[model samples]
Structure formats: structure tokens, C-alpha cells
Target: MEKTWWKESVVYQVYPRSFMDSNGDGIGDLKGILLKLDYLQELGVDVIWLSPVYKSPNDDNGYDISDYQSIMTEFGTMDDFNRLLSAVHERGMKIMMDLVVNHTSDEHPWFLASRSSVDDPKRDYYIWRPGKDGKEPNNWESVFKGSAWKYDEGTDEYYLHLFSQKQPDLNWENPQLREEIYSMMKWWLDKGVDGFRMDVINFLSKDQRYMDGNILDGKQHGDGSPYFLNGPRIHEFLQEVNQRVLSDYDVMTVGEMPGVSPDDAVLYTGEDRGELHMVFQFEHMDIGGGPEGKWNNEKWDLSDLKGILSKWQYRLEEVGWNSLYWNNHDQPRVVSRFGDDGEYRVESAKMLAACLHMLKGTPYIYQGEELGMTNIAFESIEEYRDIETMNSYEELVNTYGWPKEKMMAAIHARSRDNARTPMQWNDGRNAGFTTGTPWIGVNANYPEINAEKAYNDHQSIFHFYKKLIQLRKQHDIIVYGRFDLLCPDDEQIFAYTRTLGEEKVLVLCNFKGQEATLTIPTELHSLKATLLIGNYEQEESDTVSSEPLRPYECRVYLLK
Candidate 1:
């Protein structure tokens, strides 16, 4: 495997909207991020991945960019953004910004011009076609569960949008558009930002034929796969993107590749791929999909989750690298999603951290993952602000006319709203996120889940995360070490070892909320090991005789 800084370091993602609010505007801003540098330094994260803070209409919660070079007014000015870059670099940490080029907001100048007239020079900048018999041009479905084409009366054409109608898909086939994106990327690279986390990068290219998708349940009948995800000429576009911009800098590039498979992951991030440093595959993250990408309360067994995770880990170890994540701004927090947040909140959080961090990959700790945050409970759908969730609910209730109760149940289980809540800074009003009303509601339990409370508690999830990152840095075995799964037969237990030269580190965890035991494999049984860091201190008996792990107990042992 190639030796890159990203291959050995841990990254933490911070949703700027929830990280902190400096101006009391109920929005997290760049100034608020500057104030939290010390806190991040304490957590020992090497990279702070900021979600898009670009000038936007915020139709997709800031993913819809109106201007590429400017910062959103709600986020502060470009000057504040530069100051944030300085603050992060000064603290010996790298900063990564979102690269959301799959589409731009309809309000963007490019889109506005494209929609002006059919024969306009900029009309081809976006995908637009004359309506078919006065209707949508193509039978494609939007990812949010509706028609992908929207009629523009003035232009006498329908534009394609894989997401919200306000966020029109960018035509990557245009060489000028490609150059512009690359130029903007180089500008950021020159500005000293460390890297980029691309949004839906696989969807950048689409089939030129505009073929129809397969009809499923009377929805738009077209091959959505061809129209979107890993479309024709995607790698060519990405390789060009890399050569002109990404390859010029030694920064990490993690693409949010939703439709990529394990084999495709190799192609996207392999040593010879020359495309991306890493890419996120939703195999593990998409365990429970509601009706058309929604979240549901469907029971997910631990074994299935472990198997999916192991498949990616083992496959990437041989092909490319994996971007390990338990939470992000688009998904619910890890602790609340996988671990028991009610009774074993702290222990389960720390245990889950230890379990995943020891694996051979670049672990990404989303903001508040270190504090073991739980899901938010919104009072009504009207209170939600995320465009994706709102559109989905509308599709179910308005277009399809599904039962409202059924939709609400799914929303509770899977809404992006769970992750979009403001950061819980303290038990103070508005969770100390903002002095004014928050753009989104705060998790009501913020008082108990704030950073202050966790930072002070020695056994808090925050401190455990610190130890986890430091261990990866201090020990070579944890970084480039080869991974081997042990005792794979045990459904409730997940265990693995990393072997670097002669150094060996073993990690064992009880994923479920019940105590479980697994016999040490022969290779590990005879090895003399010392407890390095654990969620709980080892009892005399546990040290003297390797005992079975209790519920949510995770420990790492270094070979002596």
C-alpha cells in the first residue's frame, strides 16, 4: 500500500451548522469553529472535515452551492473562513472542505443562465431537453422519490435533477465546467486547505442516451443507475479532476460514493486508480433502508452488521483503503444508532469507539460522536429543515398518499433530522449553540450530552476518543498494520488483530448490550499481552486470567 498521511491519521467531520454559533444567529459559523480549535486539539484528531459552508440557497442544507468561491453569509465571510483555515493549520491539524460538484443550486448563476433560453450559450451547462409531448422529457426518478425532470415554462424544456428541483444536476460533459471546477479546487488547495470530502461524486457523470429506468411500483420508468451513480465517463472525469487539481496537492479526497461496490471501491481508491484517496460505501451504513432510502424501525441483527463491515474491511485490506465511519452529518449518531443510548450510554459509546478505531483504516469521528449523542425527537414534520427528509415525507403523503402514521414511523427511525440538530455544547439554553433561536431544534437531552460534561468526565466518550487517536499515532502497528479477524463464528462478538512486523494488537468487543465471551484463538492465547486502553479498567481477575468481556466492554491489548 502507498504511504500517505491520510492512510495513518484519523479524521473528524464537523457539520458547520451544528458545531457552534458565534453571532447568536442560531447557526454555526466560522468564528464558532475558531473558538473550538482547542477542543478539537484535545480530542487529538488529525483532520477536521467541514461540510459545505459555501454560498448556497441551503435547499439541501448548504449542499446546494450558488457560488463556488464565497462562503455562505450565515457561515460568516471568506475572511472568517480564511481565519478558520489559519486556526486549524496553526494547531498542527489539517482542514478539509466539502466538494459538492455533482450539482449546483438552481439559483446559481450558471443554472440561471442555462434556464434562460433553449439556444443560449449556457443552456448546455445543465442537462435540459424538450418535454416529451408536453411532459417530462425522460422517465427518471429523483432520489428523494419523485420525478427527476421539472418543466421550465420560459425555456420550453425540462431540466434533470437527481435530487431537489432547486438543485439541478451539473453537466460534467462540458469541458468548460470541468475546468471551472478544477480551477476552483486549485484555488482552495492554494489557500492551504488540506483536502476535500466530495459529495455524491459517483453521480457526476450520466449516460448520454437519456434512457428510461426500470419501472418499480409505477414510479418513473427508467434506469436510474445509468442516469446517475457511476455513470458513463465518471472515472475519466475524476481522473481529469485529479490530474488538474487533486494530484497537485498532497491532500485527502474521500468521495461519498453511494452506489460503489467493494470491487468498485478498489477501482475508486486503489493504488493504481489515481482517482480518490478513499471513498465511502454504504454497505454497512445502509443496513435498514425504509421505503426508497428512508429509515425504518426494522430490526437489524448484529451479525449482519458485523458481516457487512468485515466484508469491506477485509476486501479493502487487499485492494485499496477504507474510510471507516460510524456517524456523519447525513446519518444519525453511531451511539444512538448502534449502541444502547438509554442505560449504557457512556460505556456503549466508548466501547463502540474502541471496537471500530482499532480496525485498519482511517477512522472518521463525526462531531458529537465522541460525546455519544442520541437521536433528536422532533415534535412535528413541520419543524424539520432538511430538504431531503421533507421531500420524502411529501412524496409518501402527497403523491403516493401513504398513511401519515406509517411515514412518521419511518421518519422517526431514519430522518436526516436526527443528525441535523444543533451541536449540544452544554445544558444551557439552545444547548449553548446559539444565543438566538437555532435554525434547527437542539436535542432535548443536550444538557446531559454537552461537550463540557463529557470533557470533565474521565470515563466520558470524549476522553476515550482521545486515547483512541493517540494510540493510532503512537503505535505503528495500528496504522499500516495488517488486519486479521479472529473468532468470526461468534455472532455477538467482534474481534480482530493488527500485525505490524512482529508487533500485534488485539481488539475485542461485545456489540450487543449483553455480556458475552469468546475463547482466545491459539495464536493470541499464548501471546503475552498488556492492556493499553480500555473502556473500563481491568479487574485483577481480568488481568490475571483473561476473562470474558461484559456487555459493551471493549479492550485493546498490545503484544509484549
Candidate 2:
């Protein structure tokens, strides 16, 4: 195993829209981010992974890019962005832009030109295919719930969109498109960006044959995802990308791969020869998405999640590096998802940080996650704004014949908007996100949970994260130590150990409400550490015993 610089660095993810608003236009902007440099410095992060701020039609938020070169006017001019880059570097933090080239807004110049006429020079820039049997080119369905191929009357062909129809898939098969994307990436690199977080990057290479999938049991389409996720020629395209732009820059790239397996991840992030530095895998996040399409139907036993993460941690440790994270712009707050938000919100939030940060991999912290934010509780469906959530909500009620109350329950459980709501800055009416009406409502608890409050509280989750980050940077073991599951078969205990030459850490977590004893392993007999951190009242002596641990108590014991 090689050294992981990312594991030693504290990464902060910025959802650009909700970060800051300088123009008073009720939206966050680059200038707004520039103004917050001091704030970020105070939080003590090594890198900031900014979400997309590219010129777009605002479909699927900013994930749909219309122009790669120009920054959205709403976000401020490119000059403002350049100043932000300089300012961030001045504060000793690197910047990583979100790369959304897997798909582009239909309004992108290439897509617009491609849609005008089939014979147009730019027609190959996007995936445009003639309808098969006068129907869609395949039995694939869009992630937004419709035929993947949309009829384009002007071109007399259908344009493929894995996500929204507004966002058409780019044809990676075309050398010209690949060259263009590489060029844009280099342009950002030249401007001094540290790296990129590729969005749904696995979605670029589609099944070459355009094969109609087998009809699902009582369902219309197969997980058409198989067609677009990690398709043929993906490695070739990634190698080309690395050779063209990434290889030349001292950059760190983390691909947002939704459906990739461990073997594929090895290819994408292996230490010996991989396309990216690391990748954000979806296995852990999907635990809450549930097996069915029902939004609020997410259910996970603590033991099951423990097994899932343990397997990934073990399997990927050998082949590739992992991008460790709990929350991002696309998912709900971590405390709400994995912890009992009502009773153990703050403690478990810090505990979750302790659990993940101790892993031998890179760790990413979403904006406000350090402050222990919880999920939003919207009163009406109209209050929701995310396109994905809105579409699913409407489907459950109007199209699928689900009761409104039942659908609302689902929406609360799995809606992406639960995470996309404006950042809650204060106790103001709009949560201080905007002086005027915000584009979306902030969680009402912002008053108590804002950064201001946390800055004052010494034992706040925010401060705990700051401490954990410092420890990760100073200690080599936390970064390179091999991991071992201490209690794999326990139904409620998620315990593990990270070992270096002579140092060791014992991490124990009791997931449920009842008190349970953690039977300390004999191998951990060398440790004589006091309780470094725990989610509950830790009853640790100078030396841990082979005693069962208490409930919801996650303790980290350092070697004395």
C-alpha cells in the first residue's frame, strides 16, 4: 500500500448555490464565496470541492452545463472566479471544481447544433440515434422517469438523456467531444484549480449496441442504468482524459460513480495505475435509497449497514483508495440518516465523523455538516423544489395512485431536496440564506445549529471535526493504517481497528437504544488509552476489558 495524501487532508464540499449570495439576487455566487474565504479558513480545511457553477439552463440545478468556458452570470464573471481562486490559495486551501461532462444541458452549443440537423458537423457531439421500431432507440428509461431517448422533430432522431431531457448525454465515442472536454478541463487547471469531482462520471460510456433490456418483473424497463453505467470503452476514454489533461496537472480527481463495483473502482482509483485519485462510491449512500422506488420507504438495520461498509472498506483497501463521506449536496444530513436525530444528534454527528475520519482513506465534509445539521421538514409538497424529488413525488401520487400522505412520507425519507435546501445561516425567517425570500426554505433549526452557534460552543460537532482533521493530518497511522472489523457478526455494534507498525485505535459503536457491552478483542490488549471520543457516556478504564460495550456509545481508544 502507498501513502494517501488525501487521507491526511480535510476536504470541504461547497454547493456553490447555497454557499453565499453576493449579488443580492437571492442566489449564491463566486463573489459570495470570495467573501467567505475567512469563514472557510476558520473552519480549517485543506481543500474545497465546489459544485458546478457553469453556464446552464438551471435544469437539475447546475449539473446541466450549457457552456464549459464561461461561468454563469448568476454566479458572477470569470474574473470573479479567478479572484476567488487566488483568494482560496492565499488561505492555504486548494479548489476542486465539479466536472459534469457526463451530460450537458440541451442548450449547450454542441447539443443545440446537434439537434438542428442530423448531418450537422456537431451532430456526433451528443448521442443521437434513430428510433427503433418507431419507438425509443431502446427500452431504457431516464433517471427522471421517462423514455431515455427523447423525440427531436427537428433532427428526425431521438437524443439520449440518462438524466433530465434537458440534459443530453455527451457522445464520448467521438474524439472531438473528448478533446473538447479535455480542453475545458485544462483551461480550469491552467487557471490554478487543484482538481475536479466528476459528476456521474460512470454515465459517460453507454452500451454500444443500444440493446433493449429485458422487461423487469411487473416493471416497464430494466435498470437501464446497466446500459450507461460503466459501459464499454470507459477505461479507454478515462485513459485518454488522463493523458490529455489530468496527467499533466498536480491534481486529485474523485469520480462520482453511482453504479460502479469494487473491481471497476480498482481500475478507476488503483494506486499503481488508475484514472483518478479516488472516487465517491454509491454503495453506502444507496443503503437509504432502499430497494424499491418508494422515497420514504428507506429502512436499514445497523448490522446490515455495518456489513456493507465493512466489505467495501476491506475490498477496496487492496485495489484502490476510497473517498470517505457522510453527507453532500445530493444527500440528506448525516446525523438524520445514521443517527437518532432527536436524542443523539450532536453526539452521533461527531461520532459519525470520528468513525469515518479514522478510516484509511480520503474524507469529504459537506458544507454545514461540521455544524451537525438535520433534515428539513416541509409542510406541503409545493415547498419542495428539487427536480428529482418533485418528479418522484408527482409520480407516487398522480401517476402511481399512491396516497398523498403515504407519498409525503416517502418524500421525507429520500428526497434529494432534503439536502439541497438553502444553507441555514441563522434564526432569521429565511435562515439568513437571503435577506429577501430565498429560492428555497432553510431548515428552521438553523438558529441553534448555525455556524455562529457552533463557533461559540467548544464541544460542538464543528469543533470536534476540526480536532479530528488536525489529528488525521498529524498522525500517519490514521491515513495508512490497515483496517480490521472487530465485531463483524454483532447485530448492533459497528466496531473496527486501524493498525500501523505499533499504533492502534479501537472504534466501537452501539447502534441501537439498549445498553450492550462491547467484548473487547484480545488483540487490542496492547492499548491503554483513555476515551478519545465517543457518542455516548464512555465508561472506559485505563485499559479496556473484554467487556461488552454500552449502547450508542462509540469510543476511540488510543495506544498508551
Candidate 3:
């Protein structure tokens, strides 16, 4: 396999609003991130994927950007951002800024002009269509709920918004708009920023002929994703972006692409494609969901999870690279979703980390993940802050007439707010995140799962993660090794091997709370195996045994 800086480096994602608060204004800011540079450096991450910090109206917590070049006032001024950038580079770490060009806040100047009138100069900058038979242009559903098209009374037309109504989709077909986006990207690169984490980049190129989608769940609108996601000319636009701006810089770019397949991923991230370094696909995240979508409560199958991950690892091995991650700002904590978040929280968290980090890809660690943070169970719907969750609740309860208890159960399991809670810095007030009241309520378990406690404990999840990061740096096989799944059908164990040249390593992880036995295959039973690292205390053994492994145990064995 080819070698690259991003390929061998570990990327840490920081949701700025939940990381830390310096001035006690109840929100995390650039200054607060500047204060935690040492913390990140000590954790041994090479690249920091900072979530959107651009100027916004806070309609979607900074995703709905209003200004491309300016920093949000809540996050601090442009000078503060410059200082943060300098500090990060000084510490020998790169920063990947969130690029949210697929859509912009309605408050943005371009969108403001586009929505003014039909003959406005910037009217074509956004996707606008006339109503169809006194209804919306098409029966498309917004990701957050309701109609995707919002009627603009001023222009007597409808504007497309895949997300919240406040976010208007940009017209990628317009060369002028594309140029503006490229100019903004160049400005940041020239200002010493590393690269970008393109948000919903696949949604940029949409099908020109708007059409109604097949209705699902008996809703008034249907999922219009098929007409927009990975639409025609996506590659052309991305290649243009690479040629005009990205190719000129020595930076990394990872596109957040939902509903992308493995074959299509190759075209996006292939070494010679010049589109992206890698893409974050959501197939793994949607493992346990049913036909009703993410909110449906369905039991996750370990075998299915293993199959999806293994398929991606193998398919992308030669052509493209993978961006391995379990938790992000948009998803629930991995420990809570897939592992035992109660009794075996620490053990399962380590196991999940080991399983992901040992894969043949670049690993991303979200904020608060190292401390084994679990999902929060808000008692009341009013306590939820995420627009997606709140909107879903209203629709499910009021429109669908679903029981409040059922909706609340789904909200507790799938809400983005589960991951947006304040970072547990210490056991003090507000989990030591801020002196003032937090924008969202802190998890009630923060007293037991805060970073301070983990840092003080030698055997805490934080230290285990530190060791994993160190091991990745020490062993090149972990980065570029060829992956092979051992037991593809095991329901309680996830086992795989990484081979690079003559070096070979086997990783075994127990996914459940009960002890499971994994017998060594006769093909390699005679090989000497040295325990490299594990979650539990165990002496280095030079031979493979048939003994049963402990619950949630993770072991890495180097074979000779």
C-alpha cells in the first residue's frame, strides 16, 4: 500500500462547543481550545479535526454557516482563531477545519440575495424551483423532518434545504458559486490552515430534474436523498476542487459522505483521483436500524457489524483508504450504542477502541471518547437541545400519534444530543466544563466518568487509549497491514489479523459481557505468539492457548 501522512496519523475530532469553556460563558470557544493544546498533544494525536467554528446563527450549532471567512462570536474572533492555528502548528499537530459548503444559513449574504426576488443576480446561487400544482416543487422530506422545500413568498418559488429550513442548499451547477467556494478554501489554506472535513459533500451535486420519491412510513413527504446524494457531476466538481485549490497545498481532506457505497468510495478517495484523502461513510453506523430509519429500536447483530466493517476494509484495501471511527459529534457514543455502557463500560470501551485502531485505516477519536463517556438519558423532551431530535419528537407524537413513551425511548437511543453533552473534565460543577450553566445539561454520571478521575487512575480508559495511540506510532504494521477476518460468524468475538511484509499481528475482542472461547486454527497453531497489548492484566505468553477469554477482553498478539 502507498504511504501518506494522513494514512499513518491518528485524527482527533473536537466538537468545539462541548470541548471546554474558558470564560465560563457556558459554551466552548477558540480560547478554550487554545487552553487544551497540551491536553491533545499529551494524548498523542497527530491531526485535530475541529468541527465547524465559522460564523453562524446557531440554528444547527454552527453547521449553518453564515460567514466563510469569519469566526463565530461565540467561538471567539478571527484573531483568536489565528492564535489557535499557530498554537496547534507550534505543537507539531495539523488542524482540519470543517467545510460546510453544501448549504449555508439563510442569514448568509449570498442566500439573502438569492431569496430576495426572481431576477436577483444571486438567485441562481441557490436551488430554487416553482411550486407544482399549488404544492411544493416536489414531495421531498428534510432530514430533520417536514418538507425539504420551503416556499419563499417574496419570489413565489421554493428553495431546497436537505437539513433544517434555515439551511438553504447551494447550487453546485453554478460555476460562479463554485469559484466562490474555491476562493474561500484558498483563503483558509493561505492563512496556514491545514485542510477541510467537507460536510455532506455528496449532496452538492443534485439531479436537475426534481422528482417525487417513493413514499415510506406513510408520511406526506418521501426521502429525496436519492435525487441529491452522490448526484451526477459529483466527481467532476470534486476533481475541479482538487485541481484548483487542494492540489496546490500539502494538506488532508476527508469528505463526510452519507449513503456512499464501497465502489463509489474508490472514485472519491483513490490515490490518483485527487478528490479526497478519505471519506466518512455511514454504513457502519446504520447497522442496527430498521426500515423506519435510525429511530427504530432494533438489536444490533455482531456478525452483521463484522461483515460490514470487514467488507469495507477489504474493498478499500487496494484502491482507497478508510476513515475508521465509532463515535462522532453526530452519533451516539459507541460504548453506549454497541457495548455494555453499564457494568463493563470501561472494558468494552477499550475493546471497541482496540478493534478500530488495529484496523487498516486512519483512526479518528471524538472528544470525550477516551474517558469512556456514555449516552445521556434525559428525563424530559424539553431538556433536549438537538433540532433533529426535537423535530422528530413533535412529528412522531403529534403527526403520527405515537405514544410519548415510545418517542422518548427512541430519542434517548438515537439523539445527536447524546454526543453533544458537555465534556466531563472533572467531578466538579458542570463536570468542570464551565463555571456557568452549560448550554446543555451535563451527563449525570460525569462524577464517575470525568477525565480528571481517568487521568489520575493508571488503569483508566484514558491511559489505555494513550497506549493504543503509542502502539500505532511504534508499529508500522498497524497502519499499512493487510487485514483478514478469522471468525466471520462469531457472534461474541471479533477477530482479525494484520500482515505487512513478514510482520503479523492478530487482534481478538469479545463484544459481550460473557466469557467466550476462541480456539486457534490448526493452520497457525505452531507459530509463537507474543502478547503485545491487552485491556486486562496478563503476562506475556509465547504460545496460543485454547483457554476462554474474559468478558470484553482485547488482546493483540504478534506472531513470528
Q: Which candidate's lDDT is highest? A: 3
Best of the two (1, 2) by TM-score? 1
Least accurate 10 contiguous residues by lDDT in model 2: 288-297
Ranking by TM-score: 3, 1, 2
Give candidate 2 regions above 4 Å deviation: 288-291, 294-296, 535-541, 545-551
Clashes of 2: 7
List, residue by residue over 1-560, the lDDT tens digit for candidate 2. 76645556889988878877766678888987887778788878899999998898898889899998889888988898889999999888999999998889999888878888878899999888888788888888678875778899887788888889898989999988888888889989998999999998888888888887766655565567767788888887888888888889888899999877777888988776748888888787887564345374667777777777777788787788888998998887888888767777776787788888888788899988888888887979899888888777766577767799887877776677777777766666566666766677778788788877787888888788888877777678778888898777787778898888877877877676667776676657756776666555545587764556554566777765
Query: What TM value does model 2 have?
Result: 0.96
lDDT per model vs. reference: 0.85, 0.80, 0.92
TM-scores for all candidates: the values are 0.97, 0.96, 0.99
Worst 10 residues of 1 by lDDT: 539-548
**Best-fitting candidate, scored by TM-score:** 3
- Alpha carbon lDDT of residue 216, candidate 1? 68
In model 1, which runs have C-alpha deviations exceeding 4 angstroms?
218-223, 540-545
Q: Which wins on TM-score, candidate 1 or candidate 3?
A: 3
Instruction: Please give me the total number of clashing residue pairs in predicted model 1.
Output: 6
Residue clash pairs of candidate 2: 20-28, 296-410, 516-549, 517-548, 517-549, 518-548, 518-549
